[model samples]
Target: MFTHRIDSATYLKLLEVQDSEKLFQLIDSSREHLRNWLPWVDKNTTVEDSRQFIQHTLDQFAAGNGFNAGIWYQGALAGVIGFHKIDWQNSTTSIGYWLGEDYTGNGIMQKAVSKCLDYAFLELRLNRVEIRSAIGNVRSRRIPEKLGFTLEGTIRQAEKLVYGYVNHNVYGMLLEEWEAKENSSTYDDETYE
Candidate 1:
């Protein structure tokens, strides 16, 4: 299993079957809040559903497609962040993430995302990474912006949530861009919070 320590109190661990109950509980607790932006929230109605989702992540990892990791903040499940899939032919991948409503305003997602970008560019040696957020999701949009991703474009009707179809703003960062950001950043992990 892949585990990354962001700080003393924050880390990301690969999801496993044993995590179903905790994952489901977190999702259930934040259902209404998550339903606003995520389409899969309602579909995950039980622990079994969460187990299946974790199994799928395992399969994806085995297939070398990508992975989903649970964000553990201060020893609690705070959210999830993952690569949707790796397009090896293009040397790129897109990241998707969601944090429980209670976990908002903590800079957890931002730091987790920054770590993912580091992995993508430094470890995986990927050419590009992308993040797409619904137009109305200001919080989600800010993550990539704060991380220095360039606004690529908008895809109309990119995703359908509970409300209706929503436009997506695509943000991308190339390997060179990430390297530049890393070399120039004055803020360390300790000060990021």
Candidate 2:
């Protein structure tokens, strides 16, 4: 039930049964927006497929494995952001996110990511979070960079893309580093915009 609203246009929250309707709507609208970047999203994916996907995500959250939040813009569904492959033993997690095409370039995703990272480090008490983006995905790479994440390295042929397997640039941020930035007098919250 945790929820956050930003700028009267965007929202982030834990998914619920009531969200299924909105979730379906978002998927239908997002198929074309995401079809290029996310290989998993197809124009033909059914509502049932999206439901099962959301159900799996919720189940993972309930099992203490991870968390996923729906992103809503201007009271309409946008996309999603989530933490996955969390290793509690190591206090680490990976961030995954996508924005509906219409909502891109408006700084909404940047703000949403800032809030998610804040929650992950300050509230969830995670030590490190990693973000990996396909080598050519400049937009995706920009999120971690804007959030002050360090560019760790590139994993050659790390993941398969729509075209084929490609190298991934890995980036990471540590809790200590985030805390230092947050506590710094020069740090500007407005930068997230």
Best by lDDT: 1
lDDT of 2 by residue, 61-87 (tens): 888888888988887777788898679
Looking at model 1, the pairs that clash are none
| Residue-level lDDT for 147 in candidate 1 | 87
In candidate 1, which residue ranges exceed 4 Å CA deviation?
186-193
What TM-score does prediction 2 earn?
0.89
Least lDDT summed over 10 consecutive residues: which range in candidate 1? Answer: 184-193
What stretches of model 2 exceed 4 Å from their correct place? 184-193
lDDT of 1 by residue, 1-193 (tens): 7899988899999999999999999999999999999999999999999999999999998898999999999999999999999999999999999999898888888889988988899999999999999999999998888888899999999999999999999999999989988977543433332
> Cα lDDT of model 1 overall?
0.92
Clash pairs for candidate 2: none
Alpha-carbon RMSD to native, per candidate: 1.9, 2.5
lDDT of 2 at 40: 80
